[model samples]
Target: MSLMPDRKTIMLVLKDVTQENQYKREKLEQERKFIEQTRMAQMGEMISMIAHQWRQPLSSISATSMNMMIKIQLGEYNLETKEGRDECENSFVGQLEKIEIYTQNLTTTINDFRNFYKPNKLPVLTSLKSVVEKSLKIIEGSLHNDNINIIYDYNFNEKIELYDSELMQVVLNIFKNAQDNFKEKGIEKPLIKITTKERSLIICDNGGGIPEEIMKNIFDPYFSTKDEKNGTGLGLYMSKTIVEDHHKGSLHVDNQEAVEGEGIGACFTIKLNLSSQSMEG
Candidate 1:
């Protein structure tokens, strides 16, 4: 007979397998929840867009109907009054046409929303520049409010192929978090230096530096410094997930060189794979 394993050995092996499986299952569940939550938020934004699209059409319908009713009451709806009746008919028809255009806009918005909110989708190659612009727009108000200056150094010699939507989210999230942090610190003449090269992008902020002790732990999920009113702690975590897991990119951070009389800062570098068109690390 083959040598028999001890009961303790068997028990330890079973425990290890059980824990590994449980860890995987839990991670899968968290990913599921995260995707669902993001999709829901996007749906909310789309709903707002849908409403915005119909505003002009609905306004045109209401205004035209009121004016037509007024003309009828004033006995001005007669076709025999020279070209006056023809003019009124033409005006009403034009307003109705405006309404139809508005309605079509609303329908188009709904279609676009549906496409964006779909699941289990793979990304196609898109430009890095477009992602930068979209992220800048999202943080424009905050940047202005904080009096922080954004200087872009677009030195990329090659086009970066990326998933447009997800990369946009990653960049936007980083900018917003930096803006908020700097705003709280009351840093004057706050400067955000954005520099991009053929294979990497760097974002630096003059909002004082990240504490040395927490440097490595910054990427840990559910870890944040801001209070409940300010931070969800997921911004950086999600950013890492987007760049690393989704885009196969690499990201790292370091302390920015200090400027005399100005506070310290942190710089984040994101490296992209231009040749492979997808990050491997």
Candidate 2:
């Protein structure tokens, strides 16, 4: 009689990843929508800044055009004699140059605002100082109108890879917050000091310090100290995300007992490191 081998057994396993993938997709979609919302919320402030930047240039252009028209109407330029013609030519050329300069100023202002709204496609080699300067240029007019002073102290200017436009947004957020605080508190001689150190950018404003109890929640999404009508509460949250999640950096704040000898205020620090991939570039 032949002996038969015992029957062999086999096992198989299957997993359903549909729910997991769906959850990921939902989270991503939510983040994308929130980013757009944040941009829209900032649009009002952006428009205000553009108006501030354009006002002076537009006024200058108008004045120059009026002056040219008046001169032509009144026959102020003697065009008969050779010498008179030379003088008229020189005057018109000077006026034209002024108009050109004013027009260029208008163009630059628009470009700055346009670039601020444009999303970056690639990381750029830049420095914290450079980014800070660009951000300041955009808001400086508004600050001047508000009588807010900016003191910039440079210590580190090393080049690093970053999404410069995104970083600019973070800087602008901090600056706008400081300005609002100054206005709200009615701080006298309002001042904001910016300092760049080894891999860190620090901004401090003498607008009274943030309350310790509420400081912890500042980075949480949709948390705001301002009234509902004034604050969408996404600025700091988006800023923290840009610095930490997108750039792989760190952002923190503290109550500075004294900032540049200007008394107690809120201070924000942004620390960045070169990414592994960017190090070679």
Candidate 3:
């Protein structure tokens, strides 16, 4: 209606545009920070997982070798004649078996990290139970230290058909969140339970439940109960994307349990398609 532009009108238009750009820049930065945070968190988780995976076998290897050395010192090993060859062979074979177990685990760890950190690909038939198992193994140390017991109620009948690495990331994210949440709340006995049947589900910690408002925004990017220094709010959001977009699955969180663990804290449910070969599942 007013074709003739006034100084106030021009100033207002410029202000609006500036504000819009600022908003976009902030959003972009938040997104970048979120991505960087995800990468860092993943790397940290992997490092810890590797250490945990290697810890037990390494300890066993050390102990076994020490035991063997002590036996040799006490003339427990017989190698004086040809008749002693069989005994020596048996003992060395046992040691070799232990070494083989350690090597096999090391190889599996390398492969798991490789698959996880590799570039994204389409979904395929992956063992869902195994994927989550690897993730749990990765964080076992932390779980033990926090007195957090993880209960895995799953049927290992069929391999879960989904994006293997993506599914793992989803599982890891939920587990880390559970552990962190429990620690933050200072709970004495933290418990995380994972169940997989028709759908893969994980439940953890029965302390403070998520608020109504936060529940609505749980899947929204940059929505976090943690402070800026602690959390970026992208973990769950990215998990949702990985499950829904990449893996053709779904991830959801409920504040209360449907049956048992009622009045408990948060529970996360993830549903994924069974691999083509998995007919019964």
Q: How accurate is candidate 1 locally (lDDT)?
A: 0.68
Q: Stretches of candidate 1 above 4 Å error? A: 1-25, 35-120, 258-263, 274-281
Candidate number that wins on lDDT, 1 or 3: 3
lDDT of 2 at 129: 80
Candidate 1 lDDT over residue span 126-179, tens digit each: 456556775564445446655778888877645555666667666765676677
Model 1 steric clash pairs: none
Per-residue lDDT of 143 in model 3: 73
Give TM per candidate.
0.61, 0.89, 0.71
> If both were scored by TM-score, which would come out higher, candidate 1 or candidate 2?
2
Cα lDDT computed for each candidate against the true fold: 0.68, 0.88, 0.72
Using lDDT, rank the candidates from best to worst. Answer: 2, 3, 1
Residues 1-281, candidate 2: write the lDDT tens digits. Answer: 32555866567898999999999999889878878878898888888998999899889889988998998899987788899889888988998999999999888988988888889989988888889989988999999999998888988757888899999999999999999898899988888999998888999988889998999999998998889877889999999989997888999999987564656899999998764222222
* Runs of candidate 2 exceeding 4 Å displacement: 1-17, 260-262, 276-281
Worst 10 residues of 3 by lDDT: 7-16
Put down candidate 3 lDDT per residue, 1-281, tens digits, no spaces. 57765634533433458888999999778766766778686786678767876777788888888877887798875688776777877887898799788878778777867777775556566566777776766677667767877766775456556666666778888888887787888865667777766656555557566777778898988777887766777889888977786667778887775223446678888877555456464
Instruction: Give the per-residue Cα lDDT of candidate 2 at 62.
Output: 91
Indicate whether candidate 2 or candidate 3 has the larger TM-score.
2
